[model samples]
Target: MKIKEYRTQFINALTPIYDAGEAESFFYLILEEKKQLKRIDLALHPDLAFSEEEIAVWNSILEQLQQEIPIQYLLGKTSFYGLDFEVNENVLIPRPETEELVDWIIKDTATPRNNQGLKILDIGTGSGCIAISLAKNISNAQVFAIDVSEKALATAKKNAQINAVNVTFINQNILETEDLQQQFDIIVSNPPYVRNLEKEEIKKNVLDNEPHLALFVEDNNALIFYKKIAELAQKNLVPNGQLYFEINQYLGKEMVELLEKMNFATIELRKDIYGNDRMTRGSVQ
Candidate 1:
């Protein structure tokens, strides 16, 4: 069928689950990935048709999309911080909010005031998005990433290779670790901060499809990862070194308090484009 006709069908199939605009965007995204054709290309060549096999392949993806699987997983990759990252069910899909956290880090590291050869560690790095992006953006950065899950770390290593950035990958659970052997100029983590009580607030697509281990914490200990990572940072961070996090929006005050109690200096919380408290930074004095 013609491109526009298929586009209409694709949107109709997904509108029940996603909004009209989102559904339309999904169609164009899949089109570019599967057929290498842009929206304007389809519009210019309205007669461009999908072959029988192509239609079958697209129908399979549509079925998965209807099942609430994320489009990023369907495409097997996603764009983060202006770079493409490979993703799977093993790791949480990188979000725009996380991109903002990355932007904050990049902006800091790229400044002329920052020293060269800055040592950075990304705790619980999934898909190596943050670590890779930092290494790619800050040419003199010495970056390392760690994750508990072997599967997730494997995927992250592959992503680092794909992105053409050198990021040291380590396999270890942050909670169980006692010390970081080496000091770092920065320690950043977007760890499992979502409380169990907040599961109901998560979208069906995210809750059902994303890796829960990378997404949640016990409600009673919602700041579990933050506390652990902060404790590590106290010893591992060089004097005046920075710590950053992609924080849970509802826990902004709690996060600030936690950092303050830990003696993290100059604590700052920043909002994302949507005006949610999505990023935080502090210096270790």
Candidate 2:
């Protein structure tokens, strides 16, 4: 069948599960990934057809999308911070807000002074997005990342290589440690800050398909990872070292308060493009 003709069928199949915009986006995403055809190409060649086998594969992906599987996972890859990252069930897909957090870091550190071998660590570096982005951008940064899941670390390591960034990946649970055993000029984490109670706020695609261990915390101790990582930063950060986090939007005040009590200097809470308090930065005096 002609590719343009299939567009209507594709959107109709998914519109019940996803909104028209989202369904349309998914149709294009699949078209690009599966058929190597861009929207303009399909538009120009309106009669360009999909082979029976290609149609079958697209139908399979449509079924998974209806089941709420993430398109990034369906493609087995995603773009983050202008680099490609492979993702799977083991890792949380990197979000745009996290890109903003990385941008904040890159802006502050992309200078001649910071090119002198700055040490950076990314805690719970699920897809190694933050660390790899920093390493890729800053050029002279010594990037290290830790994750509790060995499977996730493996994927992150592959991503680091794919992005051609030199990041040291470690398999260790940050919560179980007392000392980072090294000092860093910067420490960043986009750790699990979503409380179980906030599951209702999540889209069905995220709640059902994304890795929960990377997304959620106990409702009673919503700040557990933040608290632990902050304490570690207090001890492990060099004097005047900076710390950054992509935080849960609902806990902005509490996050600033926690950092203040921890004696972090010049704490800053910044909103994402969505105007939610999505990032925080603090520094050791």
Candidate 3:
């Protein structure tokens, strides 16, 4: 069958569940991945055909998409911070807002005070996105990442290798550790900050498919991970070391307050592209 004709059927099948724009996007994403054909290629040719075997594979993916499985997991890969990462049920798919948090760190460390050797750590580094991105961008950074789930760490280690960056992956729960045991110039995390009450706010695709261990916190103690990581930062951060977090949009005021009470200097709360308070930074004085 002509690929154009199949594209129409594909979009129509998903338009009931996803919007027209999203369904169209899924069509093109699949087209590029499966056929190595971009949207323009299909548009210009208007005669590309899908073999019966290819149709079977696409139909399988379409069925899963209808079931609300994330396209990243369906594709088994995603792009973040200009690098590729393999994602699965074991890790949360990295988001664009997290990229903003990473950009902030990259710019901040572009000209470090001591550039010879810089140490950095990422807490709850689910996919190792932040750690690997920083290590890839910053030439002198020695990056380390920690996660409680060994399975998550395995994926992260693979990502580090795939990105050709060295990030020491550690399998330890940050909440259970007494000391970081070493000092770092920077510490960053995009830990579980979604409150239970906010589950309704999450889209069905994410809530149903993403790992909850990397997504949720008790509503009453929404800052549990932040507070614990901040305490550890107090002991582990070097003098004037910086800390960064991708936080829940609703809890910006509370986050700034938490860092303030902990005596963090130069605290800055920044909004993401959507104008939501999505990232915060504090420096140890």
Candidate 4:
């Protein structure tokens, strides 16, 4: 089938589940990944045809898309923080807001104001995004990451190796853990802070496809992970060491208050591109 005709069919098939714009974008993304064909290539050569075998494969992906399966999982790989990562059901897909959090850390560390050779730890490092990005960008810093799921840890380890950045990956549940054996100059987490009561606010593509263990907490105890991580940071952070979190937008004030209650000085709350209160940071005295 000609490329343009194939795209029309793909969009028509997906329009029931996704809007025309999304379906059209998905088609282009799949074409780029599968055939290495960009929009320009197609525009210049509209007569490009798919082989019978390619048609069969496209049909398989189209079926999954119609069911609302994430295209990233179908591709088995994704770009995060300008690095490629292998993702599956075991880990949560990295978010753009998390990338902003990483950029914030890198900027602060690279400034002449901060000392060199800083040590950092990333709790709940799904896909190793935060830890690996810090190690790659900061250059002089030592980075470590921890996660509860062994499967998730395995994925994170693979990402660290692929990025050619050395990060110590550990397997441990943050909630049940009490302390880190070594102190860090910075401790960060994009922990599971979505309350179960906020289910209606989440899109079906996320709630149905992503790993719930990495995405949610019980409604009554919504701050469970944040509290535990803060307690550990109090014990593990060196003097003036900073703690950071990619927070739930709805709980920005609550998160800042929680850190203040723990006596974290120089507290700051920041928003993401969407203007939601998305991250919080503070220094330990």
Mind giving the per-residue lDDT tens digits that candidate 2 earns over 19-92? 99999998988888877888899889888998999889989998998899999999999999889999999999
Q: Which ten residues in a row have the lowest lDDT in candidate 1?
A: 106-115
Cα-based lDDT for every prediction:
0.93, 0.92, 0.93, 0.91
Residues 1-285, candidate 4: write the lDDT tens digits: 887898999999999889999999889889999999999999999899999899999999999998888998998888888999989989998999999999998888877557388899999998898999899988678899999999999999999889999999999988878779999999999999899889999988788999999999998888888899899999999999999999989999999999999999999999999999999999989
Off by over 4 Å in 3: 112-115
List, residue by residue over 22-122, the lDDT tens digit for candidate 3.
99998988888877889999879998899999999999999999999999999889999999999999999999999999999888877756544789999
Which scores greater on TM-score, model 2 or model 4?
A: 2
Candidate 1 segments exceeding 4 Å error: none
Those runs of model 2 whose alpha carbons end farther than 4 Å from true positions after fitting are none
Q: What is the TM-score of each candidate against the true structure?
A: 0.97, 0.98, 0.98, 0.97
Look at candidate 4 and tell me the lDDT of residue 126.
Answer: 87
Please give the ranking of all candidate structures by lDDT, highest first, separated by commas: 3, 1, 2, 4
Q: Report the Cα RMSD per candidate.
A: 1.0, 0.9, 1.0, 1.1
> RMSD to the native, candidate 3?
1.0
Per-residue lDDT of model 1, residues 120-162, tens digit only: 9999998999999999998788999999999999999999889
Task: Give the higher-lDDT candidate: 3 or 4.
Answer: 3
In model 2, the number of clashes is: 0
